[model samples]
Target: MAMRGVSHVEVFVRDKVSAVRHLRSSLGFAHVADCVEVDRSSALLRRGEVQVVATSGWATRAFIARNGEGVAGFAVTCDDVPAAEGAARALGAEVSALPRGRVTVTGIGDVAHTLLPADGHDPGAPPAGRRWVPRDGAWPAAGGAWALERVELRLPVALRERYPAFLSRVFGLERHPAQRSWLYSAPAGVTFALEEQRAPVPLEPPARAAAGSPPAASVTAYGLAFRALPAPVLR
Candidate 1:
């Protein structure tokens, strides 16, 4: 079966205010949600049909620091995990045991995914790739050459095989020798890629509301060229 289009791009941010401001002012993102949990703090913003999630989590800090500031993770909706998992394994992915409770599916690419039970997620909850659009506006633009595309992560270069293997296990992806990278497709013909960056950048400290709070800095963001961006402020 086909996988659903990207629901959203999740980012680890340093400053909630600055991240939100940058997306809203510099990139035209609109604030969607803001609040703090018992320990973590987070803010949601959107531009066009893409959702940008910024979270300040105690655990997420290390990931941001080690990986550098940039796109951290991606989410995809698939029809069947078992089948996809099989395909990924055939391609040399390193599959890990499923996690309890969360319906997790982990593999190499440093990618991890969870299945949304048949009942579905909450009403106003933000889906993975869909967060870029606002609650009110022109809505999302339609049709693109490739429904999804992403810039590759710049690993230590030493971790090339290791990273790709991880992706294979986690998302059930397959490496395309032709492209010299891994790829996976959803039932809808929407495809995602794991590319390689020329250089990797260092991670920055996250911004915070005050002392002893979660960091607010986002790792990094990739530019998506919509087949057509709306004229009247597309977010």
Candidate 2:
């Protein structure tokens, strides 16, 4: 019925060391898996309940030369692909078929979303949101920085205002609790915030983006997982 919150976000980086360090030491992300190819490498990382898929290769080099380290794309999970696909299509989103029960839902500015069908939910699972419960070595004092809170995407001035409504209509997102903000809440409590930057920032697609691909922006920053971030020394 509702779109599962963000499944994962892709980040493109030039230096895997610095990026991995920032995400791990600074942001409390833990490495899950990695892949190394002839000229590029990537790894999957996690913090709290969110997942970050980072890729580095030739496209990453071009991306860094152009716009620096940023998010390449994001994915979401839903119960019904046909309904979600239909919603995306009705809004002029370019829906592309993918192998293995996947679909790419492209929004304005060519925002790429790989949609996948969700697994059956457990009936007795705890309500999913920020977990304030204490975990050893998980606090800033214990060498933790922060967990990802939300995602921010800066769009063109022309499209900034309309996109949220578009998201609301298609993704079934509601306004973030902050009231009067650009943030929208996806199911499972994940959120996406939008803004119109002073200058139109280029959409920095992942280094693997196809040539002449639609112009797309990058994910600039992930919000703190908690509402109020703990005071810590940001290196």
Candidate 3:
């Protein structure tokens, strides 16, 4: 099985509209698509190779109620979904099959991992049950100016020794030779690090502010690092 790096991060928010607005206005992301179902609404945004799916509604309310607004899970592209799912199961990960042959597995805290087939399809497309409707008007050109550098995950110190090995075996990531930090990297240029915490920290939901106030900090479990690329030199 080949791990093709993170395809997208799914964040469960109380307000999808607010989340989408903040990302587009503050982070230079472009809203690409929207997915609406009976129980949920999702907005897909992209900036360079990074994709974010902000979702709200009944399906996400339970997660937000417990952990507050934060990342519910993330999807990674895999060459063989069955092989990857089997490997993760054998390594003690709780695995479940989803619609359209997708597989989801347990990860640290409330974070789950969804395995998506890397079949040369557009990675930013909405998942099953969500129809993709392109947004109107021109979107800001990414021009490969943004690259996801790292994903930081915080876990209880008790699992420090075993969790890194589990991630390596399941995702085929290389373990960085650091005794203090459990860092793993993939060939696709993204790093996943397990930071030790005394206990799981619940992310506080973004506070409701008066209209026209600055956006509040996004509630997220994954600490993301992004690099801005230099403008291309013109001859």
Candidate 4:
């Protein structure tokens, strides 16, 4: 595959209407409805260099019903979409064609991913800090002072152990072994980490989580791994 790296991640939302607001204010993302999208008009939330697409209304409801609304899909930038699709087939993956310059490649859990053109980070150079306004004339307020850094893929204990190898095989990511989480460096600079789908084993107590949780997005919301901004001192 001529994979450059991750282009953008499509996070299905159980609550699309609210998710957009939370992403904007609570996470420092601006909801920019600028770029052209594939299949649907996605809610484009961007910050710094990170971009996330989420479908709205009925499409949002349907996908959430079937997949439980987390990061159901992500896109990888490649030299060519068709060639990457072929590469996915060579690796025994299920590939499907999508409209626009997108191609779906399967065999990674219930996640549906696609291959996109290897364009630079921001093709249009859309300015940052511009608030995304809705058709209804209402605008979401921005409050948080953090940017999206990385994303953590919460998987079942059984799947967590195997997913790193799967991504390595498919995306050609270099696996960087960590103490608890397994990190895979995408050629595009961002990383995809796999963590046990139990309670956050690193911080939260075991009691906070049930005995056996299903590998569903309902349990883990796909939010940014933020690096806290400097806090202002109160007088």
Report the lDDT tens digits of candidate 1 across residue range 78-136.
Answer: 55556555655666655443432123444444444444322243323465322334444
Give the Cα lDDT of each candidate.
0.49, 0.59, 0.70, 0.57
Off by over 4 Å in 4: 34-42, 56-69, 80-84, 99-101, 119-122, 125-148, 156-158, 179-181, 196-221, 226-235
RMSD (Cα, Å) of candidate 1?
9.6
Where does candidate 4 have its weakest 10-residue lDDT segment?
200-209
Q: Can you write out model 4's per-residue Cα lDDT over 35-151, one digit (the tens) per residue?
A: 233434457766545567765555555445543546666766676667657656776678877655667787756566767666543332322223434533543333444333455
Q: How do these models rank on lDDT, best leading?
A: 3, 2, 4, 1
RMSD of each: 9.6, 11.9, 5.5, 9.4
TM-score head-to-head 1 vs 2, winner: 2
Question: Lowest-scoring 10 consecutive residues by lDDT in candidate 1?
Answer: 219-228
Which of 2 and 4 is the better model by lDDT?
Answer: 2
Candidate 2 clash pair list: 59-207, 149-224, 149-225, 203-216, 203-217
lDDT of 2 by residue, 44-158 (tens): 6665455676678885675445334565677777777778788888888888887657788775753467666777533112112223232242422212323345665555677
Q: In model 1, which regions exceed 4 Å deviation?
A: 85-102, 107-111, 115-125, 128-148, 154-159, 165-179, 182-235
Better of 3 and 4 by TM-score: 3
Taking all chains together, the TM-score of candidate 3 against the true structure is 0.72
lDDT of 2: 0.59
How many clashing pairs does model 2 include?
5
Off-target runs (Cα >4 Å) in candidate 3 are 97-101, 137-143, 154-162, 177-179, 195-222, 230-235
Q: List pairs with backbone clashes in candidate 4.
A: none
